[model samples]
Target: METTFDAADFHQTKLQNQLIQQLAAVEAQSNSTWATQQGQNSTRLAIALNLI
Candidate 1:
């Protein structure tokens, strides 16, 4: 019984680690996309101001 419990606990911990890693990856991707969008927007603004 103890062995079975240990196995289950280990499996649960492994799954939790995987979920955390996946979440971190998603957050990083979102941040990169937001940064890119901000850069593009500022570039457009700069061009518009120069034209004016």
Candidate 2:
């Protein structure tokens, strides 16, 4: 019985860690995508101003 409880706790901890890692990865990806978009917009604005 003790072994079973220990195994369950270990599994829960592992799952929690996995979820946290996944969330961090997703947040990083979103931040990167947002930065890229901002860079592109800045470039376009610069180009438009130069054209005028």
Candidate 3:
């Protein structure tokens, strides 16, 4: 029982670490995309206002 519990705990910890790393990567990508979109939106808004 002790050995089984230890193995399971180790595996769970590893999986948690992997999930955390993946989530961090996704957050970074999302932030980068958002920044790019905001810049485009500002440029578009400026052009539209100028046309008006």
What does candidate 1's lDDT look like per residue over 1-52, in tens digits? 3445677798999999999999999999999999999999999999999999
For model 3, what is the alpha-carbon lDDT of residue 26? 100
> Each candidate: how many clashes?
0, 0, 0
Candidate 2: clashing pairs of residues = none
Q: Quantify all predictions' global Cα lDDT against the true fold.
A: 0.95, 0.95, 0.95
Residue 5, model 1: Cα distance from true site in angstroms: 6.4
Residue 41 in candidate 1 has what lDDT? Answer: 100
What is the C-alpha local distance difference test score of candidate 3?
A: 0.95
Expressed as tens digits, the lDDT of each residue in 1-52 for candidate 2 is 3445677798999999999999999999999999999999999999999999
- Ranking of all predicted structures according to TM-score, beginning with the best and ending with the worst: 2, 1, 3
> Candidate 1, which segments miss by more than 4 Å at Cα?
1-5
Best candidate (score: TM-score) = 2
Task: Give model 2's TM-score versus the native structure.
Answer: 0.88
